[model samples]
Target chain A: MQFERAVSVEHVQKNYGKFRAVDDLTFEVHGGEIFAMLGPNGSGKTTTIRMILDILKPDTGQIRVLGGPLTEATKMRIGYLPEERGLYRNVPVLDVMIYLGRLKGLSGDEARQRSLALLQQLELDEFSRKKVSELSKGMQQKVQFAVTVLHQPDLIIIDEPFSGLDPVNTLVIKRLLTDLRSRGCAIIMSTHQMQQVEEMADRLLMISNGQQKLYGSVQDIREQFALHAIIVEGQGDWGKLPGVVSVEPAANGNGHGADRALLRLDDQTAPGDVLAAIAASGDMHVRRFEEAVPGLNDIFIQVAEGAH
Target chain B: MKHLWIVARREYLTNLRRPSFLFAAFGVPLFMVGLMFLVTTLISNAEGDLDSLGNIGYVDRAGVIAAADAPFVPYADEAGAQQALQDGTIGAYFVLPADYVDSGEVTITSREGAPDSLKEAIDHLLLANLTPQAGDDALASRLEDPVTLTVRALDRGRDLEEDAAIGVIMLPVVFAVVFFISAQTTSSYLMSSVVEEKTNRMIEILITSVTPLELLFGKIVGLGVLGLTQLSIWLIAGALLLQSGQGVPALSGIELPLDLIVISLVYFLLAYLLFAAVMAGIGAVSNSEQESRQLAGVFTFVSVFPFFFFTTFLLNPNSPISVALTLFPLTAPLTSIIRLSLGALPVWQFVASLLLLGLTAALVIWMSARVFRWSLLLYGKRPTPRELWRVIRGTPMTAVGTAAQE
Candidate 1:
């Protein structure tokens, strides 16, 4: 089944006096996809999310959620987990979750059942009746996450969802996001963590200083910043080969009984030609050969630094 | 509307279950009853002690008294009365002057201080002996009661009944106190709740589900209901206690004016909205609960300040100061109620004051909504006066990035 656009922001400009928080930003998140919004602190990621949620209106732009303007009904189908985490500290975890779910348009029984099931799935069922203040930070974060998803919203927006979670819980959330996406939910996440973005994001928009620096599919972005070279393993002293501009030892410490070397090709050299040459070199043994693609972290740093 | 109800229900239920609400709702009346009991017991013991005193001896030199009352025993001479007092045969002795009726002079000698009951008994006995005989039925009826003065109001052209007069004088103050207590409690709760939500960032989640106006109105209605609950408990307890014949003596016989009660409720709601909006605005701009409370203190002082001039207001609700207070939005709730209770407020004045209060309340609520929406995510520092003014004037807050520049 083809899913419609979950969110579309067009020519959105938000300013606080003389400073621009989001400048002519345009993006779209389709259903069944995890779209990551990557930005540094104070980079207007939250402001953009708030605008999408209708908590703040854009100074000059239009935002469509679920293929229409954000009405209360549309808001009911959207879930948001804010960066600044909060719940009623004195209220029981299940009760808070149920309250939030009800606010999102769930019936009392439905909210309760969903909250309980979510708690059980998240391994928080034992603490369901405990006050939120009594829970650990991670537990509280899980409860907040449960509240965000309890109503089975079609679009879920989470900011810094993994800030306080440990590795196990992070994996838990990652799996949940994947599961949600598979079930046709559009998830937009804002975070500074590039590794998580790389692992989960189908497409991403990276902003710096409230302006878009990079946006595209994760694979496409990585390919755009690719080193135009091949990485070869297995004892290669390949600097002497024709069409080789430079060769550097790869820093990756994969102990696969071979030394890795990065081979940068000249402008006229094709990757097939380099492979043919490496094959012709009888003294050299090649175990692995592949194009060198940049990781999201490196791309993020390069793009951010280049923008600055 | 549904979101508003959900938020309001949550607030009402959560607050109702709090220990503080329970303690305040039940503990205050119990405390009042205990205090009344203590005072009544002390007064009764004192009167009991006074009544147990022995009889007093009296000496009449010019025969002002034909015979002494039961609590008094007449002596033949002053020397005999003094001997009886010295011998402890009487608690004390009273000596009447030779021209007692003309001079109205008497002397009492006692080991202890004068007892009021004994003195009153002796004075009554002497007065009975000094009365002149009536010659006819009409003169005797006139002698029984010398004079009577009836009071009438010139403006209303009617005699004020005793209970109505008392109600007129006291109801305003009662209403004012009740309004102050109820509005103060609810408004303070509104402020603290806003501050708490903002500080905890729960508002961010809430606003996503409902508009800021909904949240504000929901909270106000919820806490208003809580305040009404508390007031109902107090009124019912007071009524029951009064019916049981153990209520406060000063309030026992006073009748509640229905008109005043209705007007007071209206004033309470308006005043609550006005003050609660002001407090919620302060809460939105404040970065901390302490800061919000400090700002709320100014408004609370303004609301209660009229009570200091309670007597002046009651005496002349038409006085310039009283009129000004009644007309001013901040002081009108209490002052107008007081004036209306005193039967001095004209219809035009009442209408004008209500209009002013209602408009001001609407304006405050609008400003509070603007401020709350703009400042819900702000932290670390309170908004500057200029920023607050801009918000109140409907200037959109610069987005987060630009806020740092300001």
Candidate 2:
């Protein structure tokens, strides 16, 4: 199982001037899993990613990729999508992808074939011959994503992988990432979007101000921060409920044939009591009722606010 | 190594397609060839000249000519020669005063312009009349082509022709300028390349793919080969010029100065490596292309500083100042080539200069690679010189940099 490690970073620290950008960062991303790095702006996520890719050297500690120090061969097996995005603007989309693929040790013919296949897969086939500058920002981002995965790397480290995409395109990329993960590709993604991670990531590391705030499975993290509340679907004025302290409106409501409400319970109010009262009132039909397991967004906000 | 070649080949091919590089590589040489063709045609035509001096009229007041050669229509007086000229019986006429022996002056008047052959014909006539060996063809021809001086430098064992001497002296200077100009242009491309990658933020992607040293060396060789390609085109143009000069009398006796060209090319390779390496560092440190060029000018000015002292170097190739410049890597390329041209270079000095140049080139490249690594991801602000120095001294960074050996 140790051989399954794609990235191993141990107590890595980086500093610019007196400010420590990444502090004692330690984690491992193994094959066949999606590991998400969660951080706010300036929380050292980019710094940590750069150090892992061997772009910026850490002040101390060790980082091993693909079970050892990065070699040219190791670099070839790892694809990175950097936070500061760019491609050769004047080069055609397919040509840029081929050049990048060749840099990773792919043959020209292999790179060409792979690039064409990826362009078609991403629905960007028509833009293959167009200059990258001609593509819209979202389209270019998708192309960048294609370039990242074209080489079929064992490990893919993408910063903000789904930023700047509409829901459809975002879903398209998410499906692709999920597929790669399913095929035993270790994916390390750095993002500020907690819901995205909650939906996709198997395990996660949350950092704030260069320190690790949390590290665990997505379910474990959500359960760890599970609120004393119940989500009531097809609901009434939950604010007036007996045990309820607050009611917050949530999504997938009206248009989905039901209205959703999160019922916050005060101390000493059991969730069983709330359900009993909902049953007693014939005024509202209770379709779904469950103790609320906090979404990653709630956990992220709580952790971030707690750190501050 | 494979990565470096991939980078270099890509760099070469990419820039090879640019119109600017194409124009620089081939256009300049073609233009020079065209200019040379024009000048050579004019010179050969001027020298390979008119059929005859035509009929002549003479008023020999000094009575030195015992008789007249063919078409020599001699008149007894200036009035008679002027009458014959007006009547168009003689193409031109000369009046030699009675004291021609003292003054050696001849007055000539004609409707038709006097060509150079006419003057030569007149001089030959006067020589045949006045000189005792006038009838001897060998002696007369000897007088016609008087002096072709060749000086042998006893110490150097090389001969200098009087006419080709200036060319030999200026050859090093011309070579130095041509080489540096190409170096400047190609290395500037290197600078822009580095800065562009950084500014465009593509370097982060690249740095992840290749080591900083590989990146630096790849770019240097890539653009260095581009300059070499340009130099090669110029060399072929030069060879063509020399070949075309085979039949042009004006170009005959001028040799290619092979020794100087070979040594200059050697120096150019070393110097270009050093210059391009430094420029790559400047590019990495600078946040913008404009800023990089501003920094580049300092090193370029130093590298070309030797050109300004060419006369001093040529006149005293063995002088202490010349020796210092030759030993200094930045100036060594031009100054040593000058000293070699002057035939004043000791084998030891030549060897030492090359050793120093090669060492300096290695040192600068190593230093630039360090700077490249440190500054590649740094943006919006430049590192202070002290910060740069500390990076060069090498911070105790952990694994995954050039810190780990290949």
Quick one: best TM-score, which candidate? 1
lDDT of 1 by residue, A132-152 (tens): 999999999998898888988
| lDDT tens per residue, model 1, B1-406 | 8988888888888888878778777887787677667776765665554456577888888876764446788898889988887888887888988887688888998867676766766655665565563124355444545664344433433233453444446656765776678788778888888988977878878878888788888898888888788778877665554455334444456555577777888888888889888998988888788988887888888877778777876566567888788889999898887666555676777888899999999998898888877787777677778878887787755543243222
List clashing residue pairs in candidate 1.
A16-B398, A16-B399
- Model 2 regions lying over 4 Å from their true place: A1-4, A59-62, A90-92, A126-136, A166-168, A231-262, A266-273, A285-299, B48-147, B165-170, B257-261, B313-316, B342-344, B395-406
Give the residue spans of candidate 1 off by over 4 A: A240-243, A252-258, A267-290, B54-63, B75-119, B122-172, B245-249, B380-406
What DockQ results for candidate 1? Answer: 0.47
Give the CAPRI rating of model 1: acceptable
